[model samples]
Target: MLYQIISFVLEVATSLFGGACLLRLYMQHQRVPFGNPVGRFVFALTDGLVLHLRRVVPSTGRWDMASLVGAYLLKLTQFGLLWLLAGGLAAVGWVPLLAVFGLVQMAISGLTGLLIVYAILSWTQAGSPLSAVIDRLCAPFLAPFRRILPLVGGIDLSPLVLLVVLQVAAMVLASLQQSMLR
Candidate 1:
């Protein structure tokens, strides 16, 4: 029970911080303006780690490599700590692979979350300021799917399709993570 609780808290904290880093990277790639509420919130949440990393990890073209590295580092730390807590020092060699697996899981989960919020906001508050930011963030990911999948009765099903695809990706990631345990 104690281990489970600790694991839960660690997961939540790492996911939020790491997710923020991934979001910052994506936003930068999309050339998203940081003046909006979503941008400000993400900046505030991730600035401390990201700013420090920026000193060492310079951007490549439009990509914010610092943010990506920061997120991966967070996952690595989280898994390393968890391994220590579980008294599994012998398996330390697998930390890097686990961290890489964690990063991919985080990315899929984060996109699924953003798409959910975007879908809800599109229905509830179509003209809200926040909606525009969500749309922009989601547009690049959803574009190819949108072109491939036809809308049904004026309702865009791209998000739903994307969500399903992400879930499948998450399942595959889970299998990879489990394989590392053996």
Candidate 2:
């Protein structure tokens, strides 16, 4: 029970910090202004680690490599700590692989979350302050699906399609993780 609680807390912390780092990378890449509330929040949450990482992994204009590296390091730390906490690092070779897989899983989960919020805000508060931010964040992910899926009766189905794709990705990641155990 205590392990479960600790693991849950660790997961939440890593997810938010890692997710914010990734968001920082994406927003910078998209050239989205970081003056808004959403931008401020993500920066505040991620700056400590990202700034330190910036020394080693320099950003190249639109590409904020530091933020990306920071997020990956956070996932690596999370998986490493969890493995240690769970009693043993029996299979040391799997740590890096798990960390990489975890980072991919986190990215998928984060994008799914943004899409969910974007879809909800589109229905409830279409003109809200954060809606534009969410839309910009979600646009690239939704674009390819949008072109392929198109709208059904004026209702966009891309979000639904993206959600399904994310779910399938999650399942595949889980299977890969399980396979790594043996």
Top-scoring candidate (TM-score): 1
Candidate 1's error at 122, in angstroms? Answer: 1.0
TM-score for all models, in order of appearance? 0.96, 0.94
Give the Cα-based TM-score of candidate 2 against the true structure.
0.94
Model 2 accuracy (lDDT, Cα): 0.90
Q: Candidate 2 on 18-116: residue-level lDDT in tens?
A: 999999999999988889999999999999999999888988878999998998888888878878888766776677888888889999999999999
Local distance difference test, each candidate: 0.93, 0.90
**lDDT (Cα, 0-100) at 162 in candidate 1:** 93
lDDT of 1 by residue, 1-182 (tens): 98889889989999999999999999999999999998998999999999999999999999999999999999999889889989989979988888999999999999999999999999999999899999999998899999999989999999999999999999988987798687
Model 1 alpha-carbon drift over 4 Å, by segment: none
Give candidate 2's total backbone clashes: 0
lDDT value, residue 100 of candidate 2: 88
TM-score of 1: 0.96
